[model samples]
Target: MNPPAEPPSRAALQAAASQRLHPLSWLFLLLAQLRAFALPLLVLLFGGGRREDGIADLIGLLAAGLLALTAVWRYFTYHYGFLGQALVIRSGLLQRNLRLVPFDRVQNVTVHQNLLHRLFGVASVRLESAGGLGQAEAQMDVLRLDQARALEALVRQGAQRARAAAAASGEGPEAATPAEPAPVLWLHLPMRELVRLGLISNRGMLVVAALFAALSQAGDAVMKPLGNQLYAGLKEGESWAASLHLGPLAYGLASLLLLLGLLALVRALSVALAIVQFHDFRLLAGERELSVERGLLSRVRAHLPKRRVQAYTLHESLLHRWFGRRSLSVDRAALETGNEAAALRELVPLATPEAMDGMLQRLLPEGSWPPRHWQPLHPRAWRRVAFPGLLATLAASGLLVAWKGLPGLWLLLLLPLVVLRARIWARYSAWSLEGGVISVRQGWLDRHWRFAEVRKLHALELRQSPFDRRHGMASLHLDSLGAHPMAPPLRIPYLPVAEAVRLAAALRAGMPRDAGVSRARTAA
Candidate 1:
């Protein structure tokens, strides 16, 4: 190489005119249009699900044309540039939008490449900001991979500089520019593990979705005609419906079997989804950063600072438990509230419990784990846990009796199953406090291991509803830096009142006063 060009000066960037995305963006926009109108496209190709051919075609063409027009307009009008420490993006068709996102508030920067972009050698860059407050602070739909990486690097630098400025404002040299980030590959899912992950992940959810789509699409055309034929056959033969009788217990058993069958179907679908999404999953740990790369159909590279993680969960679904493995998700402090995808970053696709321990140790050496005794909640915790389940069982039985007459009394059989589940939960759920960290083992059919450093604790609360109060039971609730919808709190429910108060008090006093990031945010 002759010489590396000097990085452009900040002043130069300030003087640069706003720029539109690469012309190739039109292709990306067209793909977006197709994705947005996928249902309509299905109706066009397969027919029957929607209205008449004429009406469906008219709506489909109008929607596609409108989507295409909007994409073109957005591509042409959108412009982005840097101004001092802020990134600015302006765009609009009839109205106008000029957004200036300060680097200090930037929470994440990600580079994404789907199959189409791969063919075209382009990527999309998203600069996410504080708490996902509004649509990403700024995003570039199409850029050459090299240019996208450069922009991501620049965004990271701007955020670093802003942090330095903030730190120096109060504590001179205390938060001086941190050392250069040193990245190390800590964990990469192997092909064998990927297969195991596929076997255990949530394919059931996809199966349910597929079932709904089939009903919505082909119900009238296929199911109705099929149902008519079945009815005709039944009328011509013995009328089995009139001869059969079912007690509530028989009904309950039938329902249970049906549910189990449905669950199996869902599990099968989840396995397929896991393979496609986690074909080459990898996690890299650094001094102050974390990197994740995964996806088979669409390559995704996610960059995260260690300080940004608020909390993480180690989940063991029933299927996963059978395979002796667990999955992990990390919640970012600045993640947007409703972004299901970005908010839950997969820390590990799948690993045996022992391997999970090793991986966590490699990524978090200071973090504690077993060989220590686990402390279960109070023995009487079973009472509180079982109370709700009993009430529900009774209510359901009563409803069945009212609707189906005396035979419905057999519904009482469900109560035992509910109570058994509660008993299992009380037996397995436990919490332990060690070395400034709190670990909770939760879930009954599925298991979860959640960790939070006590020093990084943000807030603590003790709760005792009337039901809990009647039984001298209380729950200790703790809040850490990160928040997530899927991530449950590091809570110990149905503990003795004294234990709850004592735990809450200890956490409040032990919380870190000097360090900025807490246990969940630690890099290692």
Candidate 2:
């Protein structure tokens, strides 16, 4: 029998040149670089009085040539790299930076080939860290889809081999078996939801339009003075009319309109870019983790391992309710640097309530499903959500009335006071808890369900105010594991004494191990 062929060495496999950027990519880079340097070069050339300075001209030429060459070298070094068991990147001129990413630590590898990339036979690869900390490690402007796919497969195989080796050397069964694959759950937002979510998003085209209008107007005001001063400086020997004559008001108006038009164009382009990046976005729920992929220019892939997710929430705004859409967010305290963990880890733009419920079941551990419908422990729980705000408003109104006469004071505060009272009342609506999960619902014009597993809870607090003590009632706040700065822990404002104790008992009992048992408990 012929001897078994030797496996290719990592260095041998990586010896071949991968791919090159399309010629157009170089042109695009050149234009962007030129724009960045143009103003500085102009300042150097024109800022000083006209002088026959051959030395300055030669110096400028040499600097421009050096800058251009440096840009080309940097791009080549960063983009070209070798793929192996550990990522081997060769970057920099004098001191090379080599990044070695072990396969087991790689959460997910995503490949994106846009229209331009397709035309050029190139793609970008994103490597998300499985450990769920720090920004994703990315390789951009790479060459060819096949190479990236091959690299991903190689890494996966190496990870499996590594695990097997570890197991043979006395690792536990859990170490041998990679975490269970996450359930392949998908939630799609209908077009109706897109419009509704976009409308209420508060950061839509209208805001962009208004911002552009303000920016354009401001830019014009700033530029006019600079332009006039420049003209005065340049034409010092010319007549006053030649140097300082302002355009006719009609002409100025036309120019303003043109500037506004340009601003609108730029704004629309930016919005289009953002929309495309978020367009047709899908979030996949897996048994082991949550995966996210989005964007066009720079594709992004994020993995939130089940162990990393601190909290899971479902929210319905007024617009969402109207359009049958719900927003789902997963919080991971591991992402502590970000301001709002909810914003960063939103599963999808829009999904139905049923879908949201299904996803919640999949993401949380066994027994962690929010009770769909249950009576609040306290009949006056609504009062808890609303009363404080109402009392504050009324007190403010009284103070104002005492200081000022009733004539305008009532006008100033009556409608607002009524609105506040109505809002507080609405917010107090209802909250409930059952089985493995706790549900807290509140909103004046919108509603939400925050579902968290007992296992997911970092800590719990039971609070009783003076009034609560008088009424023999208390409040429960459940703290989930994520990094949402603005999110208050789930608050159950009013719970009667007995029911509060019962709920606390169940929470402490811990979730049952069997999936069926957990479901049965929730049903019970």
Candidate 3:
């Protein structure tokens, strides 16, 4: 008898249907690359009569030619397909890469459209997977807007099938049937609220914007000479005050006036940025997802799975607190892969304390969602705060004396400010655990009322520093899935040592019994 035919190899058995990106993908890729060079091009345009144009033009043309060639090459070489339980992409012109993204592991599918894409009627699609760290596992760089949406629907169907198959065999994460989220408006921030958000936000961002504007506005003749002078003075070790030939007092006064002018400019720019970025801010909560859409000239539409929201941070700056307003953000797990678009979203531009609490209740429904009463930390917390302020005051005094000589004695008047700060910290910094939530209210100058559902807590710890131990105090720290480097740490510092340990234990008790309990093995 003929030997049984050898079983088909995996690749042969699971055939992939190959496809190319949208034909307009070349233009999309080319523009995506060219956008980064826009700043450099603008800088060259303002060469201010200090530089010749011929060399710059030649270099720009060559760079543009190379970028276009690469885009063309990439479009021709790349291919993607649905292949046996995975979406596989074979890409790269010189060195090929094969990426197989399993349907069961897909975390999210994102669609993006910019002005150029919208103008051309094409969009971008990104497939996010677990552990990808904020970057898409595979992206369909350009497609018709409807096509992108269709691709997203296809992925969701695949994921649902995978989950259903797993459940049939008694293993797999369960999810409800996927459906289009009918838009439900939770909040629509008005222009007035956006303006208030501007006042509370940082004004320093204006300096960066102004610097870019100056590069484009000033000619090479103006910018180059100014740059050379600043560079030469720095290389020569001459202070700016000394270089101007002004006396110490005149230099000091002039510097102060310049700073005041900068502050005014920053305030104006902040207002403009707020108006531009949040002109028609709208938040929508759906059955399975939450979406935020904002921006005036260019738009951004971002969504987060409701179950993937790991934490919430409400920031109330001193100015905001004074005005009885707070801003809210949610940490989305989609950012774990380092996706810039999936970072923490400001859900509320500006709201009163009561309004914020109501929003939180709607977002995280627990027995006692946002516990009102906060337990005060150890009294020593204020002393811990006081020492740092005093140190800062002393440092400021020394710097002033070195800069302007005898006039620096004015720094002594700041001692009262330090005392006031300590009192503020003593009054506001506290935490509590009520019902099934962990609540913390913190900050002296800029305050926030933070809370998380206990069932969501992933990890907890208690620690004591040398100072903390000496003062009979410890700190309690909580870790959730979506930790952001820029967001504030969830820590309650300067709590009684015993209290801190108790809090840790309580959080451990609150965790899911089926998930976190460690099993002890008996000796074999």
Candidate 4:
């Protein structure tokens, strides 16, 4: 029997000729182009057009043919290869383009395989660097799965070598030890946990709202019919209820029950969606990188270098508290764009508080967790928070009184609730600076804890509002690379101006020399 063949060495692979994309790349590219123009094409085909002459149909066919030809041209022109420690890519037909990306600058490598790609034994590979803003530095539409994996491995190896060389030159040979090969399993979310996560999240409501907005944008032609059908259903429901001749209390109870039933249905849909999206979710940690694998219909495999993580966030919503769960996410140096944005955010989507603490300890051994003492904000911070609520309440009450006279007086009852909320927020919100890590906590009901190593922070801002200046208090904002725009900011609000200034100086002093910390003062 013939012996099994050994895998090729790095030197051998690098010496090999430049590689082109898989033969089926054109098909995938065509499909992508069609998806991008799907809305316009649908309008051209079905909307009022030259149907008798079939001119619109002819135009669509011609457009599709042109797209197919372009895809083929792109496939034939694009070529990629390795040159020393950099990956070289050459493309473009009319105006040739060449790009060389050094492995050390690559922060994340993602491999995606939808159902179609999996069926065809192919995968889409994306390389994300720190300088691409929110876009991937390079994307390979479709490649053989084995070849893609090989390319990822090569990049990882090259990056490791670069890091080792830098460490040896800067910190001596002891700091340049090779990374461990064994991978540690960090988390494996079961179906039950996914269901819990879905229950805790408002994804279902967001999806419903998005659908409603889309329907509203479909113009009266589509929404008018839907509105009519809904109105007719409501009329039928009212008639049926009247036929029952139910008492007022009974009617109220029935309506409440119906509302609850609808909520239950929405929650069920959310559970199913979560299960489909995160089935068989697993997070693994190697010495130098973290690996995430998840999804049911469209599998995704992503790799993030450990050093690329810039900041960490812990979230605990009211629903999460009820379920005894919390979530953990990270801001990495690479900003993933498009469908890949959701790839590596949820390092721990849902877990017990104790479990999350343990995971954090294992993942970030350099930093401390659960600070022993939290530094409180200014003594009058509660008043600062409550003032806005009080003003808003007064304004709303005045408007309601103008609209409905004495009946609107009841709105003033919300004033106390607003004050209570502000008090809670002021009491819970705090900051901690310990062991080269800076942590900030905020929120009353849905709490967020954002933290980062001092060295990772790139900028700091101190701002003073007119009210803040009058009260001798200010706010501090800490900026890190690749932070999610929608996530709660890492800001410490309502701090004494002197304290804020001292804190900013201390943080800047702790930052690494090469980090180039920038400070700014702004008035708002």
lDDT winner among the candidates?
4
For 408-503, candidate 4 gives per-residue lDDT tens digits of: 889999989988998889999999998778999998789999998888888887888888999999888888888988778988999999999899
Give the Å shift of residue 302 in candidate 4. 1.1
> Candidate 1 on 1-524: residue-level lDDT in tens?
23434655644553453777888897688887788779768767567655554777786778778888888888887878877787877778579766777787777777888888888899998877656754676778999898899888888888778778767676334385765576778778777787787677765576678877887767667888878998999696545533567667876897799799877776667666777777687787766677788877788877777767766688988888788888888766665532224423677768778877876665443647652668788787877778878888788888988999888889788888877888899999888887667778889888887877776667666777777777777777777765676687778787887887777777777876643322221111
lDDT of 1 at 159: 76
RMSD each, Å: 7.8, 10.4, 7.7, 5.4
Winner on TM-score between 3 and 4 is 4
- The lDDT values for all models are 0.74, 0.59, 0.74, 0.85
RMSD of 4: 5.4
> What clash pairs does model 2 have?
182-286, 182-287, 182-288, 183-286, 183-287, 382-428
TM-score of each: 0.75, 0.64, 0.76, 0.90
Question: How do the candidates rank by TM-score, highest first?
Answer: 4, 3, 1, 2
lDDT of 4: 0.85
Deviating ranges (above 4 Å) for candidate 3? 1-16, 35-63, 81-88, 92-98, 173-183, 203-224, 227-264, 322-324, 334-344, 391-413, 455-459, 511-524
The candidate 2 region of ten consecutive residues with least summed lDDT is: 515-524
Candidate number with greatest TM-score? 4
What number of backbone clashes does candidate 4 have, counting pairs of residues 3 or more apart or in separate chains? Answer: 0
Better of 2 and 4 by TM-score: 4
C-alpha displacement of 380 in model 2, angstroms?
Answer: 4.6
What TM-score quantifies how close candidate 4 is to the native fold? 0.90
